[model samples]
Target: MKKIEDDIRKIEEEISETKIILPYGVMSITLFDLEQYEKIIVNINREREKNQNLEFRKSLIKKYKFVFLSKKRKLNKILNNLKNNKVEFVPKIESVVNKEYLQKFHTYREDISLKENSRYFLRQRINCCINKVNEELFLLNFHPSLYMNSMDEYIGGDFRYRYDAEAIIYEDVNILQSESHHFAIYTNEKTKEKTKRDILNILAYLNGTPIFLFTQNPSFNRKIDDLYQQFDLLDMLRLRKNEYFKEETEESISLQLPILKNYNNYSVVLFKTLKHAEIVDLYHSSLKQFEPLPRCVFLYRVFEYAASVDYKVKIRPTEYKQEDAIEYYIEKAIGYNPNPLYYMDFGSRKVTNYFTKLKLEARKIFKEWSEHPYKKSKTRGEIIYNIGRNLVAHGGNGEHNMKYDYDKNYKHINDVNIILELIARYVIELLNPGLKNVVERRKIYYEKQYTL
Candidate 1:
């Protein structure tokens, strides 16, 4: 009971300084001043209920209830945790005003129906409330094998990409290139778990080298607590002196392959869809393995996931092996007009010839393991499914199983990985065609970088 009383006293002292002033003769109320704040909240709810405009009501709810009420709940949680003996707790109130809310805020401010003074007042109020929540918070994570190249545009500093619109200028994330290993630090608001998942998915699909990281640097969150200086925060990142981070030999040479360069143009919808797929978990599992055999097992799980999803192409039930479904999807994906394969100019020679050469080599390797007696009888789709996807995964049908000799078959596995990567790229293209050009552009750049 004494502990609870002490926590209550501390919270009351903090709450006294938390009053936010609104425009248009509204009373100032701290979040802890529940009775007064509740009256305002109730009034907003009533307005939302009575207001006939469906869109206007939605705007009110998104801006007011979703943003402010959520802050109230978070405050309560922080106080509760404090009472439970959790020390050094700071309210992450800034999280509520993320990219999603910023869009709504801009939209609301632009309405010609609302008086200019009223709009000005609301904007000021919002800025005042949210800006206080800013303290140069960085959610940090380190990659094991994969590293990033510095862009010519942002030399010395990290490559910062803003997924959300430029309306909120401060909202952007930096993928930093340290000495041998790479780490990413995101500004604005993201929980550590969500940031880990987001960075992994971005690296996996965009770069094609699925990499894993040690747990996030807990020190960054705790060390920077109440430290709001931008220069001080940046100095810590440059040092990169965390015990968790260490350099390792690059596993997949595929990291040298061309990767998507321009990520700033993509919408939140793309990210949300990628998260929903949850490929990172499978890729993370694959990356933890030292040998290629176990790696192939988890890598196949990604293909298996794609196979399980619904697509326009329908296969007969008898024909629908896990590999077959994915094979069909890959074929359908590559058939897009202008084709992603030709997005970059490799040389005067047609790209088809290059792909054909690769296919021929892959086919010869496939011949050794395919169930079919005659390699000539099988289609391109079948070769990819049987050899690239399945053969490396679970050794081929007859005597030439890949698992017998890791060193001898390493080249074969790599050759198969190239073909499989193309299939994976096409799968991503199918999901969001807007990314095709970006993905191809990055691949071309990476190829040049690798040769250099």
Candidate 2:
């Protein structure tokens, strides 16, 4: 058997010692009142779908008032229930060493409030997916109810929506080597989609830093919730070198995933399951010129290379291999340090082909965005922290000193990592155009919501 991770052991110890308490003093789940809580949950979820008013939803929060007892305090009651034939009982193995895995089921809680109950379905789906992967779960996360996070960071641009999702993170000491560590992160749908990408960036965080190992792909199986594999940087760059050589269309049933549409009261079971398939297609198609990477990934890479040259941060490739060919290729693919041989063999061609396409596509994207009526340039107040408030140029253009928002012009430059993220499917959708089938299918399920 694999050795239990030490951090996980400590966390399990803490959980066992502390009696859990939900927000707003909603009594803990230590004891069941001999009622099927699932039925109550179903009813609550139903009302949430039908209702839309924010106040009404807030009012529903105070409904759960059941008193709960600790496992030890409730043990005699459980035995009495079994004695009276109210329930079936099983004997506990007192001699066995106590640990979380030793327990039959590990129940975790998210927000006990009614406001975000819809996410429970998403969590259930993620849980189901994890169960399929067969890895021993180490830690699980649930949402916090009643209290929205007190985030003090600056909010510059308006978002489509801001939401934080609850997820489970598994800690493994060393799946590959004695020195290396591994962690698996699983979220309930939208949690993976952060509204505002920060300066610190997503990849830098998910690289298994602070807690565990390096992340390559950070992508999961759409059909089955498997651990995200590291994106093969070398392989992806080589594809770039080859002008995005793509494999022939090989659609299979396993690629299909049922999409959730809130119109069906947010049902995951799709009547037509090709929504994910077509999305997978569109996402891949957008990156065909770059290969095995997303549109944003290629866009960022191109931007990085271009800026590196302009700002003189760029290092020209040279041939200096400390070891063998494979190791050399791996280093070259990482693109941190470069040599002339790398450029001649791969970089020169990739850069040329990539820049050519990027120039054309970026122009079109800019034109469309500039012409859109409802579109507001989300660049205002972006440089609020700048000494000049907004960067200013005292050229005295027409009359007074000209106001130049240098930050807006240098948005990507100001933030070196503007859109870094795990190459997950939900993330892919955020970058790619929606496929026709997926778009059309969305109409049936996005029933107009009356609820907030």
Candidate 3:
């Protein structure tokens, strides 16, 4: 009876050891935490280097490789969730080899003839939540007394409103008496960047008016709080490529209903034809500036836009191509010395005299350019671009004889300011000729009214 008990005790010890003999040698499976798996692999590698037995190495590889591969797949599953930023419960490394993962590894390790077919299925169901969110968000850009005929019209996906439910006229935050109208665009885009881009594109169409301020409010649902946003004036100004002037009030332009309505139609055509839409926004915004420096920069942009399209403007490496284009356009379209009254007329003597002075000073500046290396002819382009535009744009660090000083060059830039506006208007008309007749009639009407 004592001998039988000893035999049973020896059998139990053998079972606990889990020793198996292969063609190479004896191997044992040690029950340890998953953290020790790396040490086991290292030991195997160290032993492999010492043992030159080919069959021994093959046996070790066949036995351990299957278990290593299974554990690696399970570990990757946990890592993938973390990589994708998903919150999930992960098993501790100590518990992995002692628990569920260990059982799977043991099943594969123990069964040398085990045939496992791993089939993985990954499915994604995209939720179409368009209807659940606000389908359209509208940005209302406000400007003072736009003089647009009261008309609520939908143009393609973008909607324009003079007075409507969505386009409510808001009182100017700074000025009490001054009320402002808006050109609103409705789109499904929710991101702030996309909304701003859409607003800019629509504002490009309203080049006839000055749009400096805007507000965005999107309501996804009534139950939740809405997001209200406004683009800060300083932030928008900072985005400008060249320096710009900021004024409290916009210098509003008055146009008849038919003329203003045609702006809508002409904008549609311009959107398709105008390759560089940024120049359009820059041109119109320059008109409302209190200072002249920004206007001069915009005037140069006008010439650049003209130069890009008109092949007749001879391109020279040393010469300013924009200035050349400006000269070419003025001479071809409205003569070198264009009368201010031909484009717009003011009832006030002071305003009228200011414009008259602008034209005379332009001629004087033209003569000054004769001494320049290029010696450009006495044209509107010569004074506006080569002289005024260059002085403000290039004059930095108090250089160019301190020409960048606003007070110092006020007279020169102010004169350039008036001429540039007219030139900008002329170029715009030249490019978008659809509203040319209407503009001409309005100019004639203003001229007659001022004369009377």
TM-scores for all candidates: the values are: 0.39, 0.23, 0.37
- Badly placed stretches (over 4 Å) of model 3 are 1-183, 188-209, 216-258, 261-276, 285-289, 312-323, 336-389, 396-408, 434-452
Model 1 CA RMSD to the hidden true structure, in angstroms = 18.5
Pick the winner on lDDT between candidates 1 and 2: 1
Candidate 2 C-alpha lDDT tens digits along 162-274: 11221111111101111112222322212322311211122122121111122343342221112122222223223222222344632111111112222122111112212
Clash count of each predicted structure: 3, 16, 0
Q: Give RMSD to native, each candidate.
A: 18.5, 22.8, 27.7
- lDDT of candidate 2 at residue 193, scale 0 to 100: 26
* Candidate 2 wrongly placed segments (more than 4 Å): 1-35, 65-452
- The TM-score obtained by model 1 is 0.39
Q: On lDDT, who's better, 2 or 3?
A: 3
lDDT of each: 0.39, 0.25, 0.37
Q: Global CA lDDT of candidate 2, please? A: 0.25
Model 1, which residues run further than 4 Å from truth? 1-182, 187-192, 216-276, 280-290, 311-319, 333-402, 406-416, 432-434, 440-452
| lDDT score of residue 249 within candidate 1 | 30
lDDT for residue 339 in candidate 2, whole number 0-100: 9
